[model samples]
Every structure is written in structure tokens, then in C-alpha cells.
Target: MLTPPEKPVHWNVDDVVVTEPDVIRRAIGAAAIGNITEWYDFGVYAYFEPTIKKVFFSGLGDTVGTVATFGLFAVAFLVRPFGGMFFGPLADRIGRNKVLAITMIMMAGGTFVIGCIPSRASIGIGAPLLLLVARLLQGFSTGGEYGNAMTFIAEYAPDRKRGFLGSWLEFGTFTGYLLGAVLVTVADAVLTEHQLLTWGWRIPFFVALPLGLVGVYLRSKLADTPAYAALEKESEKREKDKAGKDIRTLLRIWPFLLVCMGLVIVWNVTNYMLTSYMPTYVSDTVPNAQGGGVSSTTSQVLQIIVMAVALCTIPFLGRLSDRVGRKPIAWTGVGLLIVLAFPMVLLIQAGSVIGVFLGLLLMGLALICFSSTMPSTLPALFPTEVRGAGLSVSFNVAVSLFAGTTSVAVGGLVGLTGDLNWPAYYLIAAGIVGAVALWFLQEPNGRRMWGSAPAAGSQDEAREVVEHQDREAVPA
Candidate 1:
């Protein structure tokens, strides 16, 4: 029986007094846990694509089986938009915590189930079928996870530091990838290649269970953001109010959604390129004559190093965005990638250790632009009511069309054109799309969200409205 405040509460973090830095720390940490688990699972599948192809799709022959496995991987992305459509409105209606909790469970369960599945040698065609089902479940849940988590973090952030705080979410994502790389690298070291194909590949999948539980616990202990809580209070007052907005009205903001889609295209392409496909590309395509194209083990380690380098810079760019504004910092990253991605591919093709390291390092830095600012930028595109759904739909649709299929597309393009630099052309094209979209977007840095202000009340009353945020800071 909460009453609506006389006026809508401004969702700015400054309005809520924070006596402890831990409040912000805990909030950011809680939001990031799910992201870590989500990306860990994705990274495992992508980084281990070679093993996965050998294990599940062996019936198809070497090259075609690898291609088929990637196709199945892309299938998960196809389901992501549906997950967003189903879960995003529910999150906007229910609460971010509840949605996050559900998504983590689904993601963890799907990943663990993949580990438990019988190998193709034992199950015949059923192995890959079961694997595909598991992936779809994981992908579906992930659709809800990213938007809800990003919006949850952004809403909790102070205006001045939203970009910095949001950057941590991507940090979790990269850390997941890093951890996945570590697991594969360790497996490669401990197990012979046969053992790796037989059992080692499943180890990373099994890790998702415990990781997901931690994510669930972190999200469950938290209170909803003051902004979402405010929305709930108002929705209760207007009993006839619904969580699902008309699709027509949402579509009217097509330009905004398109801009988000374009940015996602840029982000996902760069992300999958450097983090997921780069290792495989370098290992498979680098010239052996020049001491290029290291073994799979070395490739995994190299990717870990590159991911580590990129991850370290994310926090800095996130903070920088807060000062210079989101657009400029984001554009700088995209611009650099567009110009350098092609050349970086050339270096990888050169087959020298120095060239490989320099190419990946440069590409990693370029990716940080989108990675650091994206959490702050995407959520700012819509007001609170439709924010979750808007981002979920737009981002997933773009990612599915571009990022999800990037590895497969690159493989095909290379086979078709016999050019190792096919990825460069793809990345550059995505960058152009991003630049065009950025032009149409207004910078939203440090701006008030939802056009909300303190309810018609005294300053003391507004302060009271946000007191729950501090109260919820008590750790579970």
C-alpha cells in the first residue's frame, strides 16, 4: 500500500544520498554477475568451436561439420529476439531483479545440460540436436539478461558516473570471456587432444551451474532501482495502466531503435571478431612459414592476452565518456576500428608473432570504444517505460543478424573469396553503419531519464522517496 509521491521521483543517483561507497559497489557487482555468467557460456562455445565441431558434428566431415556447428550456434541468436519480446515487458512490469534471477537460472541450466549430453559417438544424431536445444534455451534467457541488467545498472548509477558504472557490466562480460579462455587453455594443457575432445570440452559448460547460482543470489538480494520502483508505484495508482506499451507507439521511435541497432551491429561485430573469431582465425589462417598460426593452445593464450588488454582499458574509457560525453568517446572507438580492422587482419595473415600480437592488441583497443560506452549509451535511448523492451528487441535483432553469424559469415566469405581479410571488409562495413547511426542520435550523457522530476513535494519528501535505496544496501 505505497502511495504515489506527489511528484515523480527523478531517478538520478545524486538525489539518493550514499554514505557508503559499498552501496554503489554492491549494486554494480550484483548487476555484473549475471553478465559474467552469460558471456562465459557464450565464450566457451565460441572459443571451443573447433572441439565442438569435432565432437558433435563429426558425421559431416571436417570443414562442413565445423560450418554446421557454427550454424547451430547462430540458431541461438535467432531465438534471442523472441526472448526479449517475452521477457522485456515483463521486466518493465515486474522488476529487474526477478527477471535477472530467472534468466540466470535458465542460462545456467541450459549450459550445464550441454555438458551432460551424450557424445555423438554414443547418441548418433541426437547429440547435436540436444546441444541445439540447450543453446536455444541459453540464448532465449540471454535476450532478457542483457537489457534488464544494463537498464538495472544504468538506473542505479549516479548521473555523473553512469558511464563509469555501466562500464563494469562490460568488464564482467570480458572477464567471463577471459575466464572461459583460461578454462580452455587449462583443459588443453591437462588433457591430450583426444581427451579434450572426449571430456575436456564439457568442463567449461559444467562450470556455468555454480556461476549462475552466484549470479542468482546476487540479484535476488537486491532491491529494485528507485526508478523502477517509482514506475511500479505510479502503475499501481493507475490500475488500468499496463506494462506492455502499444507496439505502434514503440515503432514510432524507429529512428532511435535503428540507431541502437546500428550501434549494436558495430559492437557485436567487433566483439565477436576480436574475442571469439580472432583466435580461430589466427590459428587457422596465419602463415606457418613465418612462424605464424600458432597451435590451438597458443591461440587461446593469445586471445586471453588480447582480451585482458582490452578489458583493462574499458573502465578508463567509461569514465572518460562521463567527462567528454558518450558519443565522442564511442565514435572514436568505432572510427579507429573502421580504419584499422582491415590492416589488423593483414598483420594476422603475416604469420609472425610480432605481427599477430600487434594486430590483436590494436584491435582489442579499438573494441574498447563500444564495449566501454555501450552500457551507458544503449539504455539512454529510451525512457523507463519502454527501455527494456526497446533495447532488448533492437540489440538482439542487430546482434543476431550480424554478430551471431559473424564467425560463420567470415568462414563462408573466406571460402568464397579465398581472402583471409574477409573479416576486415565486414568490420569496416559495420563501422560505416555505426557512423551513420551515430549521426542521427543526440548525446544523452548526464541527462535526466524519463523526463522525471521530484514529485510535487518538499526536498525532504524527495529525499524520503529515495531512502529505500540506502536501506536496501544492507548486504544479503
Candidate 2:
């Protein structure tokens, strides 16, 4: 059995009891809603890439405009690491709840502004430039949103069910992407392609505003996590102790960060491939291949159904991880990707809707293990004080440098190699990296959180302070 703290730590703040199922559900809802808003905007943008290219970058010509449009899409990722660095510490310092509120506003505002921007014909170079600015703002907000939401929701969870609850955060992301697909697919069915290009594309972006508002209200009303409150009290008592929350201290644990980065590389690469890039890949490659061609609308609807299946399956995998542990569950997904990528890609290449659906479903199933386990797994690697900072920095850096480039990189690789299987190859390589990292990981399923103990090499005085609190406090 895993070890627990010898005694419970005392703090000035009231314990935020999360054992109640109602509290757990609320925490899950608060964390998940913001993710829905954030990814919905991204989904809308990605699904409408062709329209965006025409409306915003028409001057570049169809070929160059396509590349430039996706290039701008990728550019937003360049700023994510910086966003993580900025927001991570703020969450660690103030509290996760308030930071969530701030990120929601930023994300919703940027997305709304994108919906309002004029076309290239109306604004010349300013259209794409405005689009770029909005993307960067949304990217910045999202960089911090995932790590902090994971941290907040994880901290609120009962240790045994953390994986399941954390998975809901990812489920929110899936739902958002699904909603984006539905928005575009439905809009296409209802409006003429010309009308979609003219104004219908903006409808999904407008939805972010209200969803973000609701997320903000839900998060703002909740009490701070018990873990963060304890850290706050501890920091107030000894301002110089840098063990749990300090960046310098966090940097010293580079090994852990690398592990986190490896996992994120796998997560983001596969994630973007399925969620962001698949439609484009299908639209471009599959139609010309074996299974017969599909319309853009058919591709979008198929993806939505696949994602809906993924959404239902994720919580079960997450709950299973809670029972069996994170590593096994994570490795299961990675293993399947390595084994199934080629077959899945081949199916997708077949061009028919059934082929696309089957291919996406297989890939989506392979991705769920990584998605569900990661939210719980990443935060537990750092102490509560530095959980936000640690997970955010590592995750965003990996995402920006590697995962964000998956679509463009894979596209280029396919162009260079004349092999449509390059995306599967890319995923296989990422899965190998993740598997290696997983081999070195210590299972953290039931680890004690921050404020449960003193620093590893703390002075006698600091030890006394920690032990004193433990002895005095009454356990729940």
C-alpha cells in the first residue's frame, strides 16, 4: 500500500471537503465547461479552414492561401509556452479558481472578436492580421487553461476517483470539438456554400461568449481547493521556503518535467491529428483514393460521430485507470496507436465515409487512454504549490515546440515523402517517445499532496513547524 502522511496538517483555512459526490460533480462541471468553450472556438476555426482561407487570405491564391491559413493556425501555438509561464505562477500564487475565471474571459473575448472581423476583400492585409491577433490571444488563454484546469479539478477529487473526474475535463474538450463539427456541418446543410463563406462560418465563434460566461460564473463561485489553501498558509508562515512552488526549485526537477513533456508530445501529436487535422487530411487525400470520395460536410459529420464515441468511452477508461493505475492505461493507448496507426491510416485513405468513420474511431480509441490519464497524472507529479507551474510549463513547451506542429509537419512530410501514411508514422514515433517515458515513471495514483510533508532536506526548524501542524490538526 502507498504511504500517507503520518498526521494531518493544520491550516488557517477551512477544508474544502470534496468527498461529497455533489462537490465532485460541481468541480468536474466547473473545470469541463471552460474547456468546452476554448476547444469549440478552435474546432470552428479548424473545420472552417477552407472558408477562412478564402475569406481572409484570398490574395495568396488557393494553393498558397491554404498553406498560409494553416500556417497562421499553427502560429498561435508559438505563444503557448509563454502563456503557460505567465499564468502558471499566477495560479500557484493566488489560487486556481480566480486564474480560471481570467482565462475564460480572455478566451471568450478573443473568439468573439474573430467572429466580428471583416474579410480580406473588406480589410486587405488587415483581415489575416486581425485573425492572427485573435488566434494568438486564444492560444495564450488555452495554454494555461488546460494545465490549470487539470490542476484544479485533480486537486478537488478524491484520490481514488481522480482519474475519472479529470477525464471529464478532457471530455469537455471532446464535446467542444464535437459541437464545432456539428455547428459547421449543420450550417453547411442549411446555407449555401457562398453563404457559409460570407457569414455562416462566424456563428460557432459567437457561441464561445455565453459558454465562457457560464464557466466563469461556475468557477468563481467555488471555494478554493484544500490543497492550495494549505500551501497558501504554509507560504505565509515561511516565505523563504521554495520547495513546492518555486520555478528554480521546479527547474531542479528537470527529469520529472521531461517525463511530463514526453507524455504531452504523444498527447498533442495524436490529439491534433484526430481533432484538428483529420478533416483536412480526409478532404485532401481520401477523396482521391480507394473507398470513394466524400464531401467536406460528410467528413465533418463522420468526425463528429467518432468524437461522440470517444467522449462516451473516455470516462470508463479513466475510471479503469483509477482502479488499475495510470501507466497501464496510458501504455494501452500508446501501444494500440503503434500497432494500429498504419491500418487506421489506410482505412482513412480509402475515401468513403464508412472508411473515414472506422479509421477515425480506431485512432480516437487509441487516443483516449492518453487523454484520460494525463490530466490526473501530470498534476500529481508536482506538489500542490508548483502543480500549476510544473505541469503548465512542461506541457505548453512540448505542445508549442512539437504537438502544435503535428498538422503542418505531417502535411509537409507527406508532401516530401509521397506517402499518405506519414501522419501514422509521426504518431508511431511520438508513441515510442511516450512509451520510453512511461517506462521511467513511478506510479503516482495515491501520492500525498503538498503541505503533507516538509522539504526533503529542510532544516530542523522547518521540520518542527511541519510536524507541529500535523500533531495539532484533527484528521477528517
Candidate 3:
């Protein structure tokens, strides 16, 4: 006899809770503040690359000093995986907020200390050594800061709006960079060469301490996320488990780990290329028959305009991802990277103010596609139990190994080959990696985060989620 069709199973509406809008806003602010602080340091460092080389590596030739300056930048990334391995599971065990607080202090402190260190003229080799130590500390702390921030915001947001909310984390990122660019530009414009080299370059690094302090204060006011709290309670009700189990469980989800890393590589290579390396590339690395590439003031101004455009557009694209699936938007970005990488580089190579601006703008546009979507997309890859550890480990490893070293790798290659188009070639390679990874990514838009109960913004939305789930459950 034929079996009757099985009835569709219904999810309980009680599982969905109305999250307060105020709570979400607070969470977004707390999470984003750390990002602003972290990237602010990067912005200052990148924009001040020329000054930093003169300050710390003045003993070396210009090319070697440029490479060494980038080497110090890359040094911070090298230790990031270690920081992630320690903090990711710790955050999973204790709470994201506590770990984030600690990292904020370290990152801000590291940046502040760099400002205080004496230059090469004052202390000889000790200056670069101290700078290396500071960068390492910043790198270690950052390994923890960003992943947890992503988790903190992602877990707090309602499923339907996570993309829009998560985009604010990157909004903080661009704000930090823009602030750095503007400061560096203003300093370069106003200060005499001797004044800038002697005293002015240190000013932007000092700003990080205040930014970090404000971030710490904001984060301290909020509690752990509702999703993490739920998971903690569930673990308490069951037998208490060792934190090592979370790491082991993360290992079991190797496919998620691989996909997460792949996407991160694509996202961050583009990110570092635009935010960290582009300043140096435009102003220093690009060859000009007249001797210098773009003028420093002009490069900084062009970058500021690109960042301003990105900052304004990110939230809109993030909201768009919520309406359409994230994959479509990501595919557009990946496609642009693959197709336009060479053309954009050619524009920058043309050496006009407008050409450079348009080139940088194209690069910025591609970078934002991943930025707007990835914060929300990545945290969804693992179940709630391992979200912090999984996201942190995967994100940091990819960034440290591949993305974080973009400047050094690209610069070294260009120095060796004398090819200005290496940046374009690198971007194309990153885009190809993104396409492969995008193929594996499940459409995370509008779905509840893995291993978490459905969340809604209001009671009516809760009811709608249940009704929608029921409709989805019905067989065709």
C-alpha cells in the first residue's frame, strides 16, 4: 500500500523573540567602535608610510626602507592567528564582550606607544625594534577584536536585518580610514618638511588612544549577545563542557572553515589593497617619468574622496543585500574585479588627477561589495556554539597569511619586476578566488543564523516568520 503524504512540521512561534531596536543599535555601536579604532591605526600608518620609513628606517636606502616599513606592517598580521587561536575560544567560553574589552585596550595601547617611541636618529636601531613590538601587539589584539565584533553584531541583529546592521561595522572601518587620511593630508599640507618629519607625524597615532577608550566604554555598557547567552544557558542546563571541545567541534566543520577562509581572502586582499597599500602604491610605487608618481597631498585627497564615497554607499548596498540575496551582490563585485582590474590600473597609471581618482574609485566600489555582505555572511557559516572561535580563527588566518601582507607582497613583486600592473594582476587573482568561494556559500540572507532560534524585531514580525516557515515547509 502507498503511504500517505507526511504533514509539514511547524516551528513554534515561541522560539522567536522580539529584539529591542535600541539594544541592537547599542550592540552595533559597541561592535563598530573597535573597528574604527583598529582601522584608524592602519589608516594613520598607511598614510604616514613615507614619514614612518624616514623616522624608523632612515639608515636604509629608500627602496629597502619602504619594504622594511611594509614588513613591520606585515609583522602584525603574522601574529594574528596566534591571537585568534587564543581569544576566539576564550570568547566562546567566557563572553565576546570581555575579550573585546581586553583587545581594545591592547590595540589602542600599541598604537599610542608607537607615537611615543623615539625616532631612528634618537635611538638608532631601537626605534624599529620598538615599532615592531608595537605592531605585533596591535596585530595580536586585532586578531581578537574584529572577529568578535562581527559575532557581537551578527548575533544581536534580527535575521531579516542582519545585513544592514552588520554593514555598520565596516562603516566604522571607513570612518577610521577617512579620519586618518584627512589628518595626514592636513598635516602634510600645513607643516614644513622638517616639522612633519620631526613632530607632526606622531599626532595621528596619539588620536588612537582616545578612539580606543571611547570604544571600550561603549562595549562595557552592553551585555553579551542574546544568541550567545542562550547558548550559554543551554550548556549550563546540560553537562558543562570543556572549551577544548569547541575547538574540536570547529575542526569537525572543516568545510565551513575552508569556505570562510576563502571568502575572507577575497574580501581582505581587496580591503588591504585599497586601504593599506593603495596610498603607497599611488604616491611611491607607481613609476613617473618626471621622478615622483602622484603628489602626496593629491594622493591623500583622492583616497579621501574614494573612502567618502564608500562610506556613504556601504549601508545602502547592505540594505540591498537584505532584499536580494547576498550572493548576487557579491557576484557583481567579483565580476567587476575580474573584468575591470586591468582597466582601473591603467587609469591610475595614466597619472592625471582624474584618472587616479577614477581608478581608486573603481577599486573602492569592488571592495565595498564584499565589505557590506561579508560581516553578516561569515558569522553565519558556523553554528552558534563555535561562531566566535570559528569566525576568528578562519578570518585571521586568511588575513594574516594572504590579505594582511598585500602591501609587502605586491610591493616586493613590483620592486623585483618593475611592473606597475602587478596590483591589477593581484586583484584579478583575488576575484577568481572569490568566485570559487562564492560558489560554495549558501545564501545566508533572510535565514536565521545557524544553530540559533529565529529572531524578529517585533511580535508581528515573529508571527510572520512562523507563517513563512510553515509555507516553506509545505512540499510542492
Candidate 4:
């Protein structure tokens, strides 16, 4: 049997129901803490770039050590697909909550172990390798964190507030990154060179123990998404092997698969280019950036201010999406980034503190537009059963190619082209692609979910359940 083409549903904004504040709060918090740790974990290496180079990866001279450690830092992003694959299906098979809760432990443990790991002077090559292993673990955990949190929050959120609610995860992510930046800055002021090289580096990792614990506790208290629980509750009424009739069934819808993957590529390319690459781009171009080269203190302070500003605006942007819909917000942000790309690059490269801050504010503010909506926007393409697998597979694959590999590629580009504007051009290109993708895209803001839009709190009363009756319907 031929499967029908899925049509986009048009909505009058009035049709959407905004979720209650309490539900939104809990969902937002649940998503936030995990992300806090994820970025915080990554930033650990970035913030301590010099200390890491000096103490952790010995035997290299100044420039060589600095370059080598940053290389290793960039290397961590390359392994995200591994984490996504492991955790994505685990969420599908077991449940999103259980899988999300488990990763917190994995992340915390990896960080703590890194804190305790011996320095390179003591253990030679094994020490840096150990740090690499810890990084990979953190990378893996972080890979799973975003997808699961997105799916989880979207599932629980009311249709209208999907954008607003989704913003919380990104808010937490940046906030956490800022926290890591701040903490490392604190250690810089308080700790001596010897203490820092020997033990000060460990504080950030050690801090993860408590933060991850808090994340674990909050996740536990969260109500299993009513949607997922409703599925299990009703599964009791259905015949057996309905489990066989899972979300993997959607892969047969090739067009949907293509759209999801392509859109994710847009998100990753622009995002990683901005977040992961900018610091290095600044350090390399503006002299006095790496080690004493970049003001670790100034860079971090600027980041905190920039991200804090971004965080404050996210909810409003998200709420605005509830009124105007998602595509507009996404495209608007992308377009602004495209427009501002050149100016942002020039300002950051100017080497003046004021110019750098202004540039970052532009970049950070542009990012907020996407952060407000991407978490809510992406996962609507998949049904609940394979929400994990479908979202994980497409996103991981896109990220593996775009986000994970972006930093190094941009780094190499900067090294070769000798113009950080190469990265700016790249961002503009990505923004243009994203902006076009949004213009022609469907808006799912007020509609039912993937297979069918279920009633807000009513499973059986799902007003629409457009199953892809075709046996091969696995890609929708």
C-alpha cells in the first residue's frame, strides 16, 4: 500500500493552548540542570586551557602545549555521535526519564574521575590519555543530553508554549557554560601557578559531583511525561506486539527523514561555529588570547554577561513564538546572524575589550533566537515510540558531521586562511540556508504531534491519529 504524503496543518494562533506555569517550570528545570553540567563539563577544559596544557599534557613547550591541549579539547566534540547512539535508543526502549537520569551519573562520574586523575608529569602519556578518556565520556553524555531533553520537554509541553518551554534547556546550557567560565576565572585569581597546575584544575571537575547530584534529584522528582505514561497506561488495553509497532516504523517516510536531517545540519553548523569556534578564533586572531594571550578573566566575564543577557530574553522569545509561530523566530535569528556576521568578526578581532563585548553580545543575542525554539521545533517530526531513535539518529548524524567536527574545521580554516572572517562567512552561509529552510517549512506549533496530535491530557481522545498505515512507514 502507498503511504500518503503528510500535509502541513495551518493554524490560527487562537487554536493553541498555552501550558500552565507550574508544568512549564518543572519541565524547564528538568531540562536545565542536565545541560548545565553538559556544557560546564566541556568548558572545564576550555577555561583551563593553559593549566591543562602545562600540567596535564606535559613534555610540550609553551606554544606546542597550548596548541596540543586545545586540539584535544576540540577532539572531544568528534565523539558525540557515540553518546547519542547509546542513549537515544535507551530512552526509546526504557523511557526518557530513566535514560536522562542515568546520564547524569555517567557525566558526574567521568568529571570526578578526571579531577582525581594524575598529572602528566606523574604518569607520562597516560595522564593526557586519561583526560582524553574523561573528555570522551563527558562528550558522550552531553551528546545524549540535548536530544532527550528536547523530546522530553516537547512531549510534556502544551502546544503554544513549546517554544517558550524549550528555551529553558538552551538557557541552562549557556548558563552552565557561563558558570564554568566564572568558576575557572575565580580559580585563576585565588590559586598560584603551582597549585593551579597541580590541583586547582580539579575544582571545576569536582564541582560537577554536587551539580550532577542535584540534576539527578530533580529528574527523579519530575513526573514521567504524561504523554509517555499515557502510552504505557493505554498499552495495557491494546494487543501485544504493539511494541513491535514502534516509532522505528516511521523511517519508511524518506522525505520526512531528509527534512529532519537537513534541518538539524542547519542548527549544528551555525551553532557549533558560533559557540565552539569563536573563542579560539578570537584568541588566535587577537594575540594575547591563549594562555596569557586571552584574558581568561575578561573573556569569561564577558561570556557570563552575554549569556546572562541571552538567557533573560529566551523565555520572551519563546513566548513570542507562541503568538507568531516557530519558523519566524528561527529564521529571524539566522538572518540576524547572517547580517551581523562580518561586523561581529571585525569587532571581536579588533582586540579592544569593548569591541569584543559588543561583538559577543551580537553573537550571543543572535543565538538566543534559535535557542528559544530549536529544542521545541526539531522533535515534532517524530512519533513518541521512535522519538528517541528517529531524533537521535538524524540529530547525531548531523551533529557528528556539522557540530562535532565544526570547531576543528574552523580552527584549520583560521590557521590556513589566516582570517577569522572565514568562520564568519561560514556562519552567514549557514544562516542563509537556515533562513530559507524556515521560509518554506511547515509550522507544527499548534498541531498534534508526529503520528497524531493527541489531546493535551487525553490519550484516547487524540483528535487525530494519522498513522502511516503502510508497513514500511518508518521515516515519518
Best by TM-score: 3
RMSD of each: 6.4, 6.1, 3.9, 5.4
For model 1, the superposed segments whose C-alpha errors exceed 4 Å read 1-21, 224-240, 287-292, 454-476
Kindly list the per-residue Cα lDDT of model 2 for residues 1-476, writing each as its tens digit: 12222355554322323345666677789889998998898788788888888899876765566677777878888998988998887777767777888899999999999999999899899998999999899889888888999988877776556788889999999999888888888887899988988888888889889988999888866656454465456544443555344777687678878888998999889999998788888986555433456788788888888888988989998888878999898988889889999989988887767888899998998889898899988887676667788888999999999998887777666655667888889889998988988887777654434443322112343344344545433333
What are the models' TM-scores? 0.89, 0.88, 0.95, 0.85
lDDT tens digits, residue span 1-476, model 3:
11112354566789785688988899899888898889889899999999999999997998899999999999999999999988887777777888999999999999999999999999898999999999999999999999989998888898899999999999999999888888888999999989999999999999999998998898877755564466456544432566458867877778888888989998999999988898988887775423546787888999999999999999999999999979998998899899999999888888789999999999999999999999999998887777888999999999999999999999899888888889899999999998988998878888777766777898888889998985433221
lDDT by residue for model 4 (330-351), tens: 8777877788889987888777
lDDT of each: 0.78, 0.79, 0.87, 0.70
Better-scoring candidate (TM-score), 1 or 4: 1
Off by over 4 Å in 3: 1-10, 224-239, 288-292, 471-476
Which model scores highest in lDDT? 3
Compute the lDDT for candidate 2: 0.79
Off by over 4 Å in 4: 1-24, 61-67, 223-228, 231-250, 283-285, 288-294, 455-476
What is the full ranking by lDDT, best candidate first? 3, 2, 1, 4
Preferred candidate (TM-score higher): 1 or 3: 3
lDDT of 1 by residue, 1-476 (tens): 11111233434435543322455677788889988998898788877887888888886875587578778878899999999988877777666677888998999899899999988998899999999999899889999999888988777676557789899999999999888888978887889888898788999999999999998887766654454456457534433475345366478777778888989998888888887677767886444324446677776777888888878989999999989998898788778778888788888777667778888888888789898998988887776667778888898889888888888888767766667778889889988988987887767665544433322123453455455433322111
Q: Where does the lowest 10-residue lDDT sum fall in candidate 3?
A: 1-10
What is candidate 2's CA lDDT for residue 409?
A: 79
Candidate 3 residue 333 C-alpha distance from true site, Å: 0.9
Candidate 3 residue 456 Cα shift, in angstroms, is 0.8
Worst 10 residues of 1 by lDDT: 1-10
Stretches of candidate 2 off by over 4 Å are 1-19, 224-245, 288-292, 450-476
Please give the clash total of every predicted structure, in order. Answer: 3, 1, 0, 16
